[model samples]
Target: MEPVVQFDHVTKNYGSQVAVDDLNLSIEAGKFVTLLGPSGCGKSTSLRMLGGFEMPTSGRILLSGKDVTRVPPNKRNVNIVFQDYALFPHMNVAKNIAFGLELKGLDNKSIHRRVSELLELVQLQDYANRLPNELSGGQRQRVALMRALAPDPDVLLLDEPLSALDAKLRQQMQIELKAIQEKTGKTFMFVTHDQEEALTMSDTIVVMNNGRIEQMGDPSTLYGRPGSVFVANFIGETNLLRSTVLGAEGNLTALDWNGITIKADQGGLSPKAGEHLYVVLRPESIHCSATEPTSGNRIKGKIRQRVFKGNHTSLAVEVGDGAVLNTLVHPGDVAQLAGDDIWVGWKPETATVIPDRHAHR
Candidate 1:
């Protein structure tokens, strides 16, 4: 299928500072794609370039196979919902949603029908007459979303639309926003620093850093098999164990960490012998036990500290040369593990290896 949006080697600069550095990406039709990264990473700048709010220093941007790179924001066939919602204080819910439709020369009856459909879509039909200030934060958010949808644009740009709500409400809205996107089947290009929100709502996530695309894939692929050290650490907490590649064994690769030989999944990358790499070990993937296991990938370690985390406990295990690795274990399992001595091991397939990229600047 042809992409609904495309950024062809787009580059944006602020004086001498490059905000977006030669970004090339494509957004498929009806797919929810998210640009995820930290502050000053240019995720928002890319969104604005596509929205016609900012123009690139070089290259072109196409929307639905048309070049809209140089077009003004008001002339583009796209709508944006900012963090503030920006609903008129005096206008009620219905009027706010119908504002865009009316601007396009739609009749009153048609505007009413479309507004009603959108209100019912968000389950806010009863609150149509209420003013924006009178409704709750979530309600106002829905109104802003409905208003953006009123124009029936090719894509909807959301700039941290739910950042204002409290934690519980924000989480609830994440699910609701995804459901709404699925129901409408519109291409949603959202921007945020929240990894959980990106993972929860995006059909494909684009992890950007240093004004470039680090990795782009489905949530499971990005989290489980990260391509770089930055991606492995940015997506979630992980234990990156420094190791030297030994040799490949079937589907696993032998790694020499400190003085201990351990095996890890190769993840389709051929690591040459004597090359420095890091094993991406998830906390939950490491199994802690009081006795040595007669099975896969066993190692001896001392439990340095334990943190109670409600349903489970986080164990900091000192494996080699004061390198502390964290593992999640059942709280009751360590009731009395004979002091701090324990075995922290994991299956060879559970851990994957990634080449060391030094560290992010």
Candidate 2:
């Protein structure tokens, strides 16, 4: 089967400032893919290029095996749900949802049937007569989705559509949106900087940085084994330590942090002797105790602060003059106190060591 969308060596530039740099990617049909990155990282730019709102400075965009590099937004079979919900205040929910159908010159009876189906799909059937202002944040978002899906486009693009809602509403909308997407079986390409959103909603995630794709894969693959330090740090909370690879045999890699020797996983990185490296260890993977650890790779430090989070405890320990390490302790195993000597330990296989020289660059 042909890919639903393909970007081949795509590049977009505004004068000398490149917004998308030599991007090559393909999306299968009916898959949920998200473009995630910080602000000004070109995530939104790439989405605009795909939507035909912005033309790529170079390369081509193919939709369902046809080149759409210069296709106008109206000519492409795609719809977008913007962050602002862009609803006409004078139009009620039903009118807003039917607007797109009317534009396509559909008959009144068919337009009514399609609008009804979309309203039910987004679970806003009861609120159809109400105006956008009468609905809640989540409801407004659903109305926006109904408007976008009313036309039954081949692809749907969401641009931070849930960012305006409160925490509870946002979470509710995430589940609702996922359910609607599954039921419709439409190809979706969402854009957001929220890592948690990308991780939770996407079949595949594309992490972008500085107008370039840093990594792309399934959520579990990106989280469990990151290809670079930027990905490890961006995806979740992690404790990074500067180190050097001493040796490697099989799955284990001997490492040295300054003068302390420890063992960690190679993390698919080929590090020569004396080469600088950084070990990424998730906060929850480290076990803490009042005394020095007798087993596993241990690091001694003084407790700087203890944060109680109800379900878990976060300990900030100062390991060196200005270096602090954070570890998450289970509520049941919360031990030690501030100003006390403590030990943090992690199994060799639990940590991933990658080259550090290029981390900040």
Candidate 3:
């Protein structure tokens, strides 16, 4: 299937500095694609370029295979829900939603029908006559979304639409927003720095850094098997161990991790003997116990700190070489390992070999 939106060799620059460097990406129709990265990582800039709010310095952008690089924001078949709910305070909910439909010259009857439907879609039918200030933050955000969807644009661009709400409201909106997208079947290009939001709502996540595409894949693929150290550290909690490659045989690569020889699955990474590698071990993958496990890779560490986090207890263990390995222990098992000395073990396949970013230096 062809992509609904395409960024072909796109680059955006501000004077001498580069904001987006040669970004090439494709967004399939009806898929919720998220641009996820930190501040100054160019996620918002890329989204702005697609929305025609900003122009590319050097490449063409296509919307449904049509070149729309120079198309103005108003001309493009897209609508944006800004981070701040940009609703007219004076206009009530109904008027706010009907604004775009009126601008498009739709008949009064049709506008009312569409507005009523949108109000119901966002569960705000009773809020039609109420002004923006009369509603809560989440309710106002829903109105903003209804306003954007008023015209039935081909793509909906969300720029951190849930960032303003509190934790509980933001979580609630995440579920609602995803359901709304599925119900409307519209292509969504969302931008966010929150990894959890991207992981929860996106069909495809494009992880960016320094204006470049670091990785792009489904949430599970990006989380379970990160392509780079930066991605591993950014997406979730994991232990990044600096190890030297002791040997490589078949799919298994042996590494000397702080005096212990542990094996890791290469996952297609070709590491030479004596070369340095960053081994990624997720905290959840490590099992801690009072006694040593009879099999698999085992290590002895001293538990420095234990944090009780409702569902599970997080233990910070100082294994060796001044490196602290984080392990998540179940609530039931936390009592037995309250002492300092503990045994941590994981399967060889649970550990993945990633390229050592510092190896080149």
Candidate 4:
């Protein structure tokens, strides 16, 4: 019962720059795991190292308990689906999927059987004879995925594989990719900067920053209880308020933010009195009204702007100290709170507090 993939204190460097710094992670079998971060955050570097495409500067990478840190990409029981799809233009879907199996010296009958099965997996069975150019963007992507999965690697490494499709297609393929992974019961290590993609598809998400992991957990845990200021702002849209801890009572900490007393759960953090901290509130957490709701932390703010976002409206309310709190209110409520001097109220427990070590301001 060992981890299907493990990175033990792995580090990768490019000259003086550290791409992945002393990383340790364990990915179990048959789960969709995503390494998510912005550009140059070392997510791709880590994936490359795991695929044996790049060697780690230090530390070991084990595949199911066997050391494969310095092994070549071809020698490892892993296959990668690059962002470009990497399919041959001249080859049809079946041929592309059969390429790896043929290189492994499988007979014609075996290759055709495997190819047919894969084509059926993606529901592209009818398109097996169609060339890459003849297929849609989503179809071409499925071809690439089936090609990588055709080899039946111990783990499948996807390096932003859905990046090429349109927004709608991308969303559609996210569900498809996850479904395929679950159906095949293959261990998938996916890499992407798209937060929504990771949230929608991954069973676990590893948020990375500056070549280091910021946090790793299930989507709801990371979104609801971010460990750092960077993570709170990165995973989703949030209003971060600079505050000073006034007092602590068990799990709740009183804060003086913008001259208003707000109580937020320390979330296991033990902050001493007068410590500087940040309170993270999601847009949906802030309730907007024209009248004060005799509950929670009520603050007055001028309605600065309202954006129409389909189902709900996004409002920018300017509070005290020139601080603007963004809140997503239902479209019905926007009409009532349209004028100046709107009341914004949110329970203190709705906010998450983080240390100000990496606060950007």
Candidate 5:
């Protein structure tokens, strides 16, 4: 399928400082794609460039296979929902939603019909008469979303649209936003630094850092099989152990973490003996037990702290040499294991070995 949006080696620079560096990405139609990264990671910049709010310093941008690198924001067939909601205080919910339709010279009857449809789409049909200030934060955000969708743009850009809301409201809005996207079947280019939000709402996640694309893939692929050390650390909480490649035999690679040797799948990457590598182990992948299990990978550690998190208990186990391994255990099973010496084990396939670029540091 042709991409709905494409960034061809785009670069954005402010004098000597670069906001985006040689970014090349493609957004498929009807897919919810998220640009995810930390502050100043160039996610928002990439979104802005797509919206024509900022032009790239070099390279081209395409919209539905059309070269729109120099197209003005007003001429582009796209809409944006800003982080602040950007609602007109004087306009009520209906008017706010009708603003885009009215700007395009649609008849009053058509505008009203579209507004009503959008209100119902967001389940805010009763709140159409309410002004922006009269609604709750989530309600106002829905109104902002309605306004953006009123025009029926091919692609909708969301710039941290849920950032202003509280945590509870943000979670609720994430579900609503994803539902609305599916209902409309519009290409969504969402920008945010929230990993959970990206993982929850996006069909494709583009992980960015240092103004460049670090990795892009489905949530499961990106989370379960991160391509780099930065992606492994950024996407979720993982125990990163510095290890040296002891040797490789067939599909398995042997790594030495301090004095403990463990085997991990090479993941198709070949590393010579004595090469520095990082073993990525997810907390949930490690199982904690009172008795030693004759299993795959096992490490003996003293439980320093245990946190009850309703569904699961998070235990911080110190293995030695100032290294602590985090393990998540079932709540019911962790009642008697707090503060005790425990054995943590994981399957060899669960651990991934990636070369560490900053191993010296």
Candidate 6:
């Protein structure tokens, strides 16, 4: 299948600062692709470029195999749902949804048909006569989605559409948005700084940093096997351990961290005899015990703090070598309290080796 949207070596600059730098990505038809990164990472800039609100300094953007880099926003078959919803206060819900069609000079009868269909699509048919001010945050968001979808754009671009809502409403809208996308089957390209939102809604996630594509993959793949230190650290909480590659035999690579030896996969990259490496261990993967395990790489640590987060408990342990490991254990299995000594261990496969980047160290 051909990619519906493609960015080839894309770069965007403002004055002397580069916002998006040499980004290359592809999104398949009807796929929900998210541009995810923290603020100033250029995810929003990339979205704007795709929306035709901004032009790339270099490279091209292809929509359905046609170059739309120079095309104006309205001329292209794309619509955006802004964070603020961008609905006019004077326009009722029905008129707001019909606004796009009206600008295109559609007849009143056709506009009513399209708007009605969209209102039902977003499950806001009953709110058609209501004003934007009268609607709740989630309801207003639905209105925004209806307006964007009323045009039947080939792609829908969402710019943090749920960011303005309260936390509970944001969570509710995330579910609603995903359901709407699946029901409509339209290509959706969303931009968000929230990693959890991207992971939950995206068919494919593009992790960007410093205006460049850091990693792109399915949520599980990106989360479980982050290609870089930045990706691993950014995607979730992890214990980043600085170590040195000791030796490798077959699939197992031995690493030495402050004289503490541990084994991991070879990671496909050959390491020098004393080459520095970093290990990323997820909190859930680390097993904490009151006593040291007979097998595996076990380390003793004093629990610095504990946080009970409903389902599980998070323990911050201060191990040797100036390293702190945050481990999550089941509430039922948690044995030690703050200031108590405990042993943490994990299987060789649990820890993945990444580049020894300074940010991770």
**Reference-based TM-score of each model:** 0.96, 0.94, 0.98, 0.96, 0.97, 0.94
Q: Which one wins on lDDT?
A: 3
| Candidate 1, position 329, lDDT | 79
Question: Can you write out model 1's per-residue Cα lDDT over 1-361, one digit (the tens) per residue?
Answer: 9999999999999999999999999999999999999989999999989888898999999999999998998888899888899998999999999999998899999999999999999999999999999999999999999999999999999998989999999999999999989999999999999898999999999999989999999999998999988889999879988899999999999999988999999988998899888999999898888889877788899989988899998889998778788988786776866579898889999999998877322
Cα lDDT tens digits, model 2, 86-133, are 998999999999998999999999999998888887777898899999
Give the per-residue Cα lDDT of candidate 4 at 325: 93
lDDT (CA) for every model shown?
0.92, 0.87, 0.93, 0.91, 0.91, 0.88
Alpha-carbon runs more than 4 Å astray in model 4? 358-361
Cα displacement (angstroms), candidate 3, residue 327, comes to: 1.2
Instruction: State the weakest 10-residue window (summed lDDT) of model 1.
Output: 352-361
lDDT of 6: 0.88
Which wins on lDDT, candidate 2 or candidate 6? Answer: 6
Q: Of the candidates numbered 1 and 6, which has the greater TM-score value?
A: 1
Which consecutive 10 residues in model 2 have the weakest lDDT in total?
331-340
Looking at model 4, residue 287 earns an lDDT score of 94
- 277: Cα error in model 2, Å: 1.5
Query: What lDDT score goes with residue 78 in model 6?
Result: 87
Question: What C-alpha lDDT, on a 0 to 100 scale, does residue 242 get in candidate 1?
Answer: 88
lDDT comparing candidate 2 with the true structure: 0.87
**CA RMSD of each candidate after superposition:** 1.8, 2.0, 1.1, 1.6, 1.4, 2.1
